[model samples]
Target chain A: MQDQVRSNVVEILTQAIPSLESKDSFALAALSDRAIELAAVFHDEDALGIALVTYAFGKLVSRGGEEKPLAPMILLLQTAVNALSSDDNSAYKKSIQRLTRHIQMVDNKINLYFQEILEKARIKKGSKLFESGFSIAAVASLLGISQWELARYVGNTTVQETQPLHTLSVGKRLKIARGLFT
Target chain B: MKTLVFDSGPIISLTGNNLLWILEPLRDAFHGTFLIPRSVYYEIVEHPLVMKRFKFEAYQVRQQLEIGVLTLIDDAKVAKLGDELLLLANNIFSSRGQPLRICQRGEMEALAVSILKNASAVVMDERITRTVVEQPASLQKILRHRFHNAISMNATAAQKIVTTCKNISIIRSVELATIAYERGLLDKYLSRKSSAEERSSLLDSVLWAVKLHGAAVSEDEINEILRIEK
Candidate 1:
């Protein structure tokens, strides 16, 4: 992992650990956003793992996962933070994987819901990357989403309207195109 | 030979709108080659061929390639220049002291081919790549808006890309549809005795279709096109 990504992971995990303890939905939501920011900026798998786990935790807290079930998930997050702090990449990866698996084991319903969240997050972040000046094809490839999905998402957004128009007018471009084709 | 290089977005947009069939007629009209770089081929066809959801779209694009409506260009020079441009583009912007990796090879490769072939224009619907080629300042503003942070630019790299791609023209699938409409190629879809209202409706529908399917065209632009056509 890049040092920047590592520092970001550690920072987010440090904030997330306490938020998980008190079932603070607001903080978790913020942390989830930060994790996603890191995921989008770095396009790193570790950042993506942290994002997925953060989102899953947010969902659990919002839906009222019991304290007992949430305890182990928090511990796994701590382990992830410790692993990163100690510069142990292997341990960090294991903790992230275990964290995800633990979430899935929490309940069958939440497991299904987590899958939905994962897909939605991918699409959302993919669209953000597109908005941030990545090509649709590149963003789709990075997030493992489809151009169809990214395009549909982008079309609905104000991306087209917000973009600075090319200096060439529509009339001029149409004329140039007409000349070419004719 | 007259040529137009294509990135994957326009092809995907056209395919999504069931307008892939228009390409053959347009190419016939242009009397030029329509080329897609290798990475674009993988994005639109090869990679999607294995995915159940997009397999049909992949096959539709593949059919165009097999029938000579589209050709693939994959050479070391294109690949090398593409990698160079990819590096330059991804490094053009930085936030928090880390450069953002914003572009992928598919679009870069297509752009590289366009620069090398000196093609008429690159047919693409994704706004970012077009912005990079046409207006780097706008891209800087876009990144600033999206990230809301201290975004910085490598002016040298930005200038390099601008100079490298200065002559390249870009058109989208929306334009292709419009050109097809003007050429009366889309007339077959209209009734035998279509009125002006019906023709306007056809134009509006096709324009919106490309927008909804992922061409980076706005409602105002579509309306403007309608007004101009009128």
Candidate 2:
């Protein structure tokens, strides 16, 4: 992993541990935001993994899932943080996987919930990347989301309205198009 | 021959709005080729063909391809130019030290084909691609606003892309809808008692349909077109 990504991951994990302990759903929200920022900048799977797990944690906390089920996941997060601090890349990867699987194993309902959150997160981040000037096709490809979904999401946003008009007026463009057709 | 290269945005917008049919009449009238890069073909047709939700729309676009309303262009030269263009475009803007990737192969390939074919224009509905080519300064402003960070521009790269694409004109699916209306192709929707108000309403509906379907056109632009048509 890149140094910037590594440090950011460590910081997020460190912050997230306390929040998860207190069941501070709002802190999870902030952690998710930071994770998303990291994901957006790096456009890497690791950052995206961080984002997904953090977001899922936030959702789970807000839903008031049983505390016992999540306790092990906190240990996994700590292990991940320690592995990163020790520059143990393989261990860090394993910890992240174990953390995700722990969440999945909590319950079938939680698994389904995680799946839904994953999909929604992909679309939401994909739209943000599109607004960041990435092409719709590129963002869709990057996020493994469908162009159809991205297009629909983008259409509802004000990104288009905020852009400056094309250098040519609508009439001039229409005239040019008309001339071509003729 | 006159030509128009299409990006995936306009294709998605048109197909979503069921306005893909307009391309046939418009192409017949233009007496020119409508080209889509192979990458774009995959984006609008091949990739979506397997997805259950969008399979029918993919088939509709594929039918247009089979009927020759849209032609697929694949050339190593276009691909090379496209990659080069993509690198330049993505590198033009950066937040902090990391260069922002703004354009992708599908969009850039369409642009490459246009630059090589000397097409009359590129029909695209993505604001960023259009803005990058037409006005990078405004694009920088947009990036700063969107990212809420210190966005920097590489003048050399921006100048190169702007100079490279200076001759390429861009229009949206919204414009295509308007063109269809102006050419009387959309008159089929008119009632027997069609009046000026009815025509205006028809134009309004068409524009809004494209807008709602993903054409990068604003309501103000639609109203301006309506006033111009009146």
Candidate 3:
């Protein structure tokens, strides 16, 4: 069962890859890394991680390039629903319900381990996020780290060496600083 | 005056344990400044505010800001210093081919602030950042002892990290709490209904929770602290 679901996820992500932009693919890869690590840690053969990964991938793909249906992602979701429903093409409503519930359970577990997995993933993916043009604070939040934790990674990241973007200006920070201290 | 820069984790750890109250007396007796970098502010304040569960803690931290217990250290000099340190530190890590992002912008900012202000110490609860700053050797020690790494590094690269991280003093929230404990600030917060022994256990419990939340206190260290003659 795990092998079946893993194959399904690999097929779906590979098919969707062509349609994705670079950063989207990069984010997908991060999610894939997380799923693989979780699978290894839990020694899970049931592909619970894959189901969660696919659902997360679907969400990321859907979030990109607004308005359009993201046809590949829709197709992927439909394929997952069909696979999850055990070939019951007729039970459209019931299959949708099962898919939703399964995705939810996977989501819950993903969030449960988010702090643990993302802490490790930050080593590789932090630079990826920076290279993909996320600001220090943005990447830090995405990785579930404090800006202090993310700062050290930013130095090693492959971000384009432009002037570092300011979330708060020096003058503004000082004003707030003085107000707090005085 | 000597300065102590705080990272978000220690703030969260202190506040989570309902021990933010200790900072006031800690500051009074220490006769130093408590600085919060802008990036740490974003983590403990701006980002967490969006989450329902952390909004209260965020609010409490904000109150500290307003009352002058925690001062924000955002300015041109500090920001520029922070950027330089970020590049320098990260370069050292990647140079070793480890590519481990051992510190974040806020931690870098904290270090930069400590350096620029001629501060006394960087108060942080994070083990990785502390190891990178005060003891790069410990990074290899931890990796070998705890996490078995297959990759190896050249001696020159390791030396670079050590040189770059020199002269940075690292302290943890546990130490600040210890200060508060000695000053009798912790006793004020303890339950009067409990006996002296129970109160001591309660203090240990607080230390245990902070350690669990990344206070840089090892289990052995915490056990020793608990067994200390009080």
Best by lDDT: 2
Model 3 regions more than 4 Å off: A1-182, B92-98, B141-149, B152-161, B189-196
Q: Second chain TM-score per prediction?
A: 0.97, 0.98, 0.85
Q: For model 2, what is the error of residue B89's alpha carbon versus the real structure, in angstroms, after optimal superposition?
A: 0.8
lDDT of each: 0.84, 0.85, 0.55
lDDT of 1 by residue, A92-173 (tens): 9999889888876777877787788777767776666677667787788777777867887777777777765565577877
Superior by DockQ: candidate 2 or candidate 3: 2
True contacts kept of 1: 0.61
Clashing pairs in 2: none
Give a tens-digit lDDT track for model 2, residues B1-230. Answer: 88999998888888888788999999998899999999988888898888887989999999999999999998999999999999989889998799887778888888899999999999988777787888877777777876779999999999999999889988888888888999998898999889999999999998888787777877778888999899
User: Which pairs of residues have clashing backbones in candidate 3?
Assistant: A148-B104, A148-B106, A148-B107, A149-B104, A150-B104, A151-B104, A151-B105, A152-B103, A152-B104
Candidate 2 shows a clash count of 0
Clashes of each: 0, 0, 9
Docking class of 1: medium
* Each prediction's RMSD to truth: 2.3, 2.2, 13.6
> Residues B46-116, candidate 3, lDDT per residue (tens digit)?
87788774788889999988888889988888788777766655443321133434355776788778878
Worst 10 residues of 1 chain A by lDDT: A160-169
Q: Give every collision pair in model 1.
A: none
